[model samples]
Target: MATLLHIDSSALPQGSASRDVTAVFRKTWEEQHPEGTVVYRDLAANPLPHISATALSVGSVDPAEFTAEQRAAHDLRVELAEELERADAVLIGTPMYNFTIPSSLKAWLDQVIIMGRTAGEKPSAAGTPVTVVASRGGSYAPGTPRESFEFVTTYLEKVLTGMLGLEVDFIVPELTLAATVPAMAELVGKSEASRAKADEEAVTKAKALVARLAG
Candidate 1:
């Protein structure tokens, strides 16, 4: 059976749009592939440290000459890379923070996107595929007025496609601010309703995809 790696990076566990939607996706996926194993990593609650300069330094020093800290960092990076390499599929749940992916998620990326593992050795080799399920409060898809504010999805797509050679797929639920306040309250209501509906549809679609892939 295939193993699925589910990484959730939203700080808000209960009310996070990204987490909530990802939960739905995972539920549908589990139903379709009940025998598959899942490894969950919550980056927001248990954040990984940023990569250090020592980890990047290359030298001719013998293995016994390496400092303890350097060895520890290298081991952590190797562990993260191994988890990603072993998974048949990876699902990342991210919410746009300051118009881009959160720092926690970026740190995780630094650990897993290792050279000679995920990518970077060959100039033209096809890389592993990853799907990101992202949630945002505003509309950022193409043709929307806020489309210009779509750096989050575009940046991820570019990095995954160009650097890692991953076939990237995105599920974005937008217009989240359409309901609660005095300004655009009605719009917010409509958008929230739309997003709720989309959440269900996305879950169904994700399940079907998983079934097809696993079978």
Candidate 2:
């Protein structure tokens, strides 16, 4: 059976656009692969510790020489790496926070991105498909005033594909706050359309990726 790692980093548990779209992706995947297994991680709720100097040095130092904290950190890193390695696909839900991904998600990335394991030349998780549902409070597409400020999708694509060697797909729901914000009233319709398109794409991509992996 196929295994999927599902991660959610949105602090807002309820009514989160990223979560909503990712739910669609996950549901579709489960339907297609009824015997598949899913591993879920809610980064916001159960946040990972940021990488410390000890964590960076854990690999170089002998296991017997490691401090208690370093040993624990190393263990967590290994667990996260194993989770990714076992999974055929990873689905991540993240909302843009301060023009980028949440700190919780960043910490999780730091933990899994090891020197010669998940990162470096010929990383272990190479070719693994990683689907990201990126929800943004404002529109940051090309030509938009905040386009340059958009770092969520770009940064993830770089780190997941370039660093960890995973194939990346992004499903973005832009202007998520337009419907609730008075100044963004005019963009509400656009936001809804964007979400609708994302919902459809999520299902299609989920099924396609799982089928390709199965074959």
Candidate 3:
């Protein structure tokens, strides 16, 4: 059976635009692949440990020479990397926090990105398709006032594709706080439009991914 590695890093689970859109994608994906497996991680609910000195040294350490602490940390890193290696596709739901990804998400990445495994020239999961739902509170696309602050997608695109060698696709829902933030009231319509487009794109992308996998 095919497997989907789904991760959600939003602290605000109920109202997060990224979570909502990822749910759409996952729902459509499961419908298309009824026998598929889903390995889910809710980072905000159960955050991963940041990479420690031991975890960072896992790739070079002689397994026979590991200390108890080092061995445990290395094992965790291997487990996380192996999960990625086993997946057919990856889905990430990340909301912008201070113009970048959440610390929880970063922690997960740290644990999983072991050199010679997930991040090297021959990344274990290289070429796996990954779709990211990146939700932002305000407009940060090119030509927008905050365009220069758009780090979430740009940074992820580089890291996922450049470093991990994953095939990356992004669905961004901008101006997510427009309806609730008083100063963004004028852009509520645009926010709604962006959300609608994101939801539609989520389904389309999920179907396309299924088709690609099947073919």
- State every prediction's TM-score relative to the real structure: 0.89, 0.98, 0.97
lDDT of 1: 0.76
User: For model 1, which pairs clash?
Assistant: 178-188, 178-189, 179-188, 179-189
Which is the winner by lDDT between candidate 1 and candidate 2? Answer: 2
lDDT of 1 by residue, 53-81 (tens): 86655223466777887777777877887
| lDDT per residue as tens, model 3, 161-207 | 88889999999999999999999999999999999999999999999
Residue 36 accuracy (lDDT) in model 1: 89
Model 2 C-alpha RMSD vs. true structure (Å) is: 0.8
- Alpha carbon lDDT at 21, candidate 3: 99
RMSD of each: 2.4, 0.8, 0.9
User: Per-residue CA lDDT of candidate 2, range 84-191, in tens?
Assistant: 999999999999999999999999999999979889998999999999999999999999898999999999999999899999999999989998999999999999
What's the residue-level lDDT of 25 in candidate 3?
99
Once model 2 is optimally superposed onto the true structure by TM-score, how far is the C-alpha of residue 32 displaced, in angstroms? 0.7
Model 1 is weakest, by summed lDDT over 10 consecutive residues, at: 121-130
Best by TM-score: 2
Candidate 3 accuracy as TM-score: 0.97
Cα error, residue 113 of model 2, in Å, equals: 0.5
